[model samples]
Target: MKARIVAETLVKGITVNAIAARHGLRPTRISDWRRKAREGKLVLPADKNAVFAPVKLAVPAIAAPTPPVPVTTIDLLKGDVTIRLAGDTPAARIAEIVAAL
Candidate 1:
């Protein structure tokens, strides 16, 4: 429950005071959870918003230019099944797939 609250505050950008007031908790308690979350002590919910993807930069080669290839893919896993989609897939399409799942 505390982890959820902290995740809501961090991922959804909700103010600690607001969550505390809504849940009848002291703001300080929520702040403590936030600190723990920052310190990797609290386990928050798995959320795409909470995820940080690494970025890589490539230098151009002196050889003839080649067509740029798409290298990223979006993977959705549920149970024992996994679905992979192009990184450039439309948001609406992804939403439909998620809803269907």
Candidate 2:
């Protein structure tokens, strides 16, 4: 019972390691108790003087944020020049543009 109390105190951020050691309990047990408390598994005593009280189990929920879309830019100077022959804008027209450039 004393060990549980000491562990609870440690969980509450109180420096009670010495007391826990005196009760023949490892600090890791106190750490586990604290973790259990956060998970709402450990119940603390209702009395103000009590070391621990009963707590409701709580599982934290996490949500991931949506990512943004990528933007692409086309730079004519850096782009490859392709000449295609079609009924409308034929290869001859492209040649004219390149000659003008």
Q: Which portions of model 2 miss their true places by more than 4 Å?
A: 2-13, 49-101
Task: Tell me which residue pairs clash in candidate 2.
Answer: 43-53, 43-54, 44-52, 44-53, 44-54, 45-52, 45-53
Give a tens-digit lDDT track for model 1, residues 1-101.
98998877874567889989999999999999999989999988887655587999899768987877875899988899899999889989999999999
TM-score, cand. 1: 0.49
For every model shown, what is its TM-score relative to the native structure?
0.49, 0.37
lDDT of 2 by residue, 1-101 (tens): 63367345744555657656766777677767767766778765555565676899888787787775543432223246644344345457656766765
Residue 43 lDDT (model 1): 88
The whole-model C-alpha lDDT of candidate 1 against the native structure comes to 0.88
Count of clashes in candidate 2: 7
What's each prediction's clash count? 0, 7
Question: CA lDDT of each candidate?
Answer: 0.88, 0.59
